[model samples]
Target: MTQQTLQRPSGWIERSRPAVQWTALIGLSLGFGAVLFWLGVPAAMLIGPLLAGIVISGNGGKLRLSRHAFVPVQGIIGCMIARMLPSSTGGELGIHWPVFAAGVLSVIVASGILGWVLVRMRVLPGTTALWGVSPGAATVMTLMAEAFGADAQLVAVMQYLRVLMVAAIASVLAKVVGANPHHAVAAVTWFPAIAWLPFAKTLALAVLGPLLGQRLRIPMGPMLVTLVAGVVLVHHGWLSIELPRWLPAIAYAFVGWRIGLRFTRPLLAHAARALPRIIACSLALIVVCGAIGAVLVAVAGVDPLTAYLATSPGGADSVAIIAASSNVDVRFVMAMQMARFLAVLAIGPATARFLARRATANANAAAAAAASSTDS
Candidate 1:
């Protein structure tokens, strides 16, 4: 009843605000994700939470998922990708190595060119444009963007924008080409049968790998370290990785929240201004990659659908889903996608760095020239 009691209630309300906001955000994300999943959208869980996060941030919500939590989540994602890329694809690669090489190189180059154009046109600043257009898995590229000094928020926008566009286009293409993808991809059971020993081992690797990487202060360390270890373990048959469905969903949600909750009004405005250019660049990359697919059809003697699916610029898992349903050579499609992923992981960093430096130097030069002319 006194002043102190009134102050205590106000403080308690302030303290509880974040909890309440997070609850609403989570509920909204799950609802969004559920709808997208029903529609068979690829990466629906991540995208749903991301959209929900953006909406929350826009509405003046103030809460962030901690970096401590986000880092381990990245490691989990890396482990997921490692397990997803099949080791058995090596045989297909051996047989069609030339075609696969061409397809991979073509897509990477096409994406890089588009990214550079975006930078040149000032559509997006610096290496954000480059990383955004990089043809790796959208989530992986989004996670790695901040480490490489790109705007992770804008990159997330660009990467996921492309993911949705590419997935929608691929679905339409699959349908037009007479591929019935209905029930092609199986729904993941919420609680699948578990191998506890392997699951525990995988979990330990996901948690510890990132800790080690962070301790060593490696850039993008968490995901890279876990990815390397996972590839080694899985390739050598030293370990069989197992993860529950919910763990990844949680990871994706947290990452979504982390990226989403950071948006400012100004940045949102900048994103809006850049949206049309982003769309055009994304479409250009898609069309170029489709042309590469056409090359594969002609030279590799693969079907048009297989060729298109193989050379799809991003969203390897999504492409895999479509491939599973079609009459395409599943092994060949997977091998191509895996090879491109590996190539991106290997070459993407150096490419991004080089392009970033180039972009920086050019901007510096332009500014200097303007100053010199003004002085003269």
Candidate 2:
């Protein structure tokens, strides 16, 4: 191949197409973030980009992101999780362990049963329902749902919808009671550092994690492997890594873009029909969790805010982000949220299997009934 043939000339408009799309994506994300922040919705970094991507997708623009594209993002999240711990379990949690543990378990069981019901009713596919209504563990659940024959785009929409709702509810409740609620996306305002060291470490880990996990046939391979490595390394003092503040937004933007790209008219219509019911059910779950929080407040002598944060159906990252600036007890909130996240992680596969079986049974029974009617 000659040099000229190999390096063909590019037109200005053609070259600008890629740049224009990316610029639009970035602009939309920032606008969404700013608006969500102004409106006091928590976790704007993730939610904003997600909604932006949906808008772009709805408008017929093509912006696709894959889980593999988000490997670095997941790695950053994993590292953040492992590194943000207070270096101790904190003795205060011991006082309310039983109550908090019960609260966490309640979220899992309640959401899982809801997932089961949704699946049996054919509201969502079995695997989609399993992870879509899950209370926490966003990265793991999304990956697992995709692995189990679910629609990743739908899972992202449903999952992030719930996350945003939970954040919205929390923000509303915070304002109702005269509390100064924290802005979870405030981390975005931090200046980006010369983060090459952390970036280098994260790059190596991100590259290695999926490869190893896939080799071992582990589920949600990249997230699980990277997260586990981060936890182990952080706890053992082998690696000290801190991601740049802006990186998380990029990660979320990519996932959102990819998800939005999948939104054709049919999917949007389905989502429009389904989202109200899903949002209503999610609010109900939050209410149930609030009752548990009330019980914790009464019995454990913790404040209502602390109890609420502990029992909130939101994921660890958002909860942690909000907890950072709130008057609530961070230790207790994290302890409870982490407990539920881990519990869901452990029990999710089993629940998914059960849902799949139930779905199969329902289909078989329906088919048999149809055959009998046909004979009649």
Q: Judging by lDDT against the true structure, name the best candidate.
A: 1
The 0-to-1 C-alpha lDDT of every candidate, in the order given, reads: 0.74, 0.66
Please report the TM-score between candidate 2 and the true structure: 0.65
| TM-score list, all predictions | 0.64, 0.65
Q: How many backbone clashes does candidate 2 have?
A: 1
Q: Candidate 1's residue-wise lDDT over 105-224, tens digit each?
A: 988988888888888887776678888888875666777778866788788777766765775676556656736445333645678889999999999999999999899885567876
| lDDT tens per residue, model 2, 278-344 | 6666676678778878888888787887788888887565565555435666667777877777777
- Which regions of candidate 1 are displaced past 4 Å? 1-16, 81-87, 90-97, 115-188, 212-238, 258-264, 301-376
CA lDDT, candidate 1, residue 307: 81
